[model samples]
Target: MSAAPEQAVAGRLSFLDRYLAVWILAAMALGLGLGRVVPGLGDALAEVTVTGVSLPIALGLLVMMYPVLAKVRYDRLDTVTRDRRLLLPSLLLNWIVGPALMFALAWLFLPDLPEYRTGLIIVGLARCIAMVIIWNDLACGDREAAAVLVALNSVFQVVAFSALGWFYLSVLPGWLGLEQSGEMGSHLLEQSRELGGVSVWEIARSVLIFLGIPLTAGYLTRRIGEKAKGRAWYESELIPRIGPFALYGLLFTIVILFALQGDAITSQPLDVARIALPLLVYFALMWAGSMALGRSVGLNYSRATTLAFTAAGNNFELAIAVAIATFGATSGQALAGVVGPLIEVPVLIGLVYVALYARRYFTTPAPLTEEDPAHA
Candidate 1:
């Protein structure tokens, strides 16, 4: 924790980690160019589907999440769970506040654009389970805390996604007389009719594929690695080897996503801008508010950073899959889903610097208990 050790750590970072933002931007540009120049490229990727989910995208997410989860000291997760200060605020932000905030922003900003609005709502409901680990780790968050929170979000996602979709898209909108706007109401009704209800089964399938596979892989890797070579070897030797893959996977996913949606994003600049506005506001507010809440509740820097990133990030993989499955790959809803990452990637990367800077404001958190694993 001294300056010399910190300096050594900084010096040890791979060129990739040090310039992650540059790589991500280059990937976006490359994907956009590929999609534009190569006819049928997006369709080709779309066709490479397994169980109705895009195979390429799924692989990227799994690869992206696996290493970070593997790095968690799973045995210490109870520390996070018993600390109600972290757990309660995280749940409140991710489950209750996040979805409602997005719904409000979507409606407020895109009242007449039913497809994009609905897409934003769906993004809000699918809480972050995959790429959030990357953001959290980059911001030097509590790894074990992130692991627990991501698991919690996955469970809540399966249980609550469909019901929330019903509420936001159909039930609550009507209750608020949002449907009274004649033509827009009729358009939304027709859109809803076309899409049917958000399928619980599909959402569950996504959670299983995206979270379950990597989580299982990570747990077994740690268990087997530690049992064979001991924790020291696993941590000091193995973790560094695998750690870079998380960012690699992230960059790969970005390229594929932008490629698939390049034409839509390029042609409909104004629509993308409309969707991006709400999303920008949503990410900024959620992250800043969660950080403030964490500091107010006396959390240290790490858990507070974890809370902010997890609350700010959405499971865009799930959101996009659902949009394509329900609304067709080319629909405005799917376009909005694509735009989620466009805004999120650079913004969250910027917020990582903001978080490291803000760390000075948080006092050292008290120990979880006498036997706090972190302190030990």
Candidate 2:
């Protein structure tokens, strides 16, 4: 698709797409209202657990994650080598710049609330793996590169998230003078110990269920469907219909969570917003930085969109699971993670529109030619 029409047309969000923010807001209202009225319901659902993860939220995470993962073009991963121009800057942004910026924002915004700050930093460490795929597709991004980056980021998260969460919550806060000693110091150490006490294996299990399962399913579905129905029809006819389910799952998850956390949220509206501040700042900063980086490097709009969304989006499910496990269900940290998707869905959707417009600023790179002296 030509970039202009793809974006102009992409701007025309469907009924669900257009009112997604409304739906999310409605979900939040409904959940918070339910929390006040039928607090028992959220409590009952929380009790229904397996493998230390909340069953309802776990189901939601699976539904939310699978469709996005299923769309990834794993077969195209090998071709990403030709995309070094995109890859080099992309790696630097997501791994290095993105994290650094998020860390700074979390600290800058949440100096008073260490638990929420820890939660935000944990999320910062886990880059967008699944949601970016959906956002990339919406913006007509380089889906192949999105898939490869998502895969690579997921692998990296499995090993790094827990370790970094420990480090950020433990050493950095004290080192930076953000945290103080005495009883508060003891409390900080306890939070760190609780977080550190979570074995990487526990997180690995969640990764297996949430990411590993869906990734495998996505691969198998692609392989089997292509064999049975052929690639063109599968891509053309089926993928579109299958994609909306991810959004549906996302909305449902929000409803249930807000119902659970609504009381806490209602009581301290400011605190909830406090946790959101760092996140909001992080998303805006990362998206702008990534767009600037991609444009400066002469990337095409598609690849640039991929990098921007990849840098801006995050793996909230994993972040949430780790938070709930490390802290109690009702902890501020868990609340910080729950609100992630509520804020994320709207922000990313808006950025998709913004990215489409921003595409014009960058010059698309000319293909390498054997006749060019630089190539020689």
Candidate 3:
């Protein structure tokens, strides 16, 4: 028999759950092409004025994040205590191993390329927000576990990003090359000019304006929907309606970003290729490292995949916003951040399949319980 409407919707998303990375990649390519052909498209869209306020590409990011954040079952947080196995691996991979290795690779491969180097760090520092949950769901991961990790990671990024940026830009350059070290301060100063004299406070305001407002609106909407009807109605009716809009908004924003940067990308086609190498290496290393840690800690296959994919993916939206604020939309740092989704999507999609098939090898039989008496 055919499934119910909700079941049909769920089943449709099942394909998306498995192949989301593909969609992201397709979006990236389409955006890149549109960007090259029609410069100023992104900027024009970004300037979409409503009541004297211009909506930037960042707004699209905020909109896209709504569905994911709204679905976060915050109440379930208490029910979901941390699994040290999952937590430690994720922490080590994201903060310690992932960033360190990415910095080293970027330095080695992109010597003297300051803007690209900064972009590499941006990718490495930001943890995945959207796709990680999709990955976890696809892998049959513990939903509560994924939600808790996302919340914790989001908190950590706020604290760590600035410090990590300073370390990578200020400290690491000296170790990488004396010439690069000497130019580090100057490069940062020049990059800062790309902000067109925008203050950090102004950037923070934009973040609040974009991310905060939408998030608040989404939460309020969800709440009202829930109170008026119940969790079932909210999930069944409201989420489905809102969810697709978020994706469409995301794609539209990406198109705009590409349109704005199309000329730059066309002029420097090789730059994208150069940036992709280190990121490719970084993704693979983090993925492998997460899996190993998960095994060492004795996590189940589903939980292990969750930890692995979470560690591997980059929160490009946050990176792009920070890049634009710090280095302007035209800066190489911003371009590098833009390059992240291009490479990340396809690679992650492949990993999803690998995780699905590899589960057989990783899965362990349930431990026998004394009360069951099956062994006895």
Candidate achieving the largest lDDT: 1
What lDDT would each prediction earn against the true structure?
Answer: 0.84, 0.73, 0.66
- What C-alpha lDDT, on a 0 to 100 scale, does residue 163 get in candidate 2? 70
lDDT of 2 at 309: 90
The sequence of per-residue lDDT tens digits that candidate 1 reaches over residues 1-376 is 3346445555656677667779989999988888888898988988998988889888998899898889888899889999999999999999899999999999999988888998998888879988888888877789899988988998888888777777778778888888736776677666655444667788788889988899899999999999999998998888878877888899999899888878888888899999999999999999999999998898998999999999999989888887877777778888889999989988998898788767757776322221111111
Q: After aligning candidate 1 to the native by TM-score, how far in Å is the CA of 52 from where it should be?
A: 0.8
Write candidate 3's Cα lDDT for 66-148 as tens digits.
76557555566575565676777677788888888888888788876878887787678777765565555444455566766
Query: Which 10-residue window in model 3 sums to the lowest lDDT?
Result: 367-376
* Stronger candidate by TM-score (2 vs 3): 2
Against the true structure, candidate 2 reaches a TM-score of: 0.85
| Each prediction's RMSD to truth | 3.9, 6.3, 7.2
Candidate 2 or 3, higher lDDT?
2
Task: List candidate 1 segments past 4 Å from native.
Answer: 1-8, 180-184, 193-196, 365-376
Off by over 4 Å in 3: 1-25, 46-56, 130-141, 175-228, 231-250, 364-376
Best by TM-score: 1
lDDT of 3: 0.66
Give all TM-scores, in the order shown: 0.92, 0.85, 0.75
Off by over 4 Å in 2: 1-14, 362-376
Clashing pairs in 3: 35-258, 35-262, 42-256
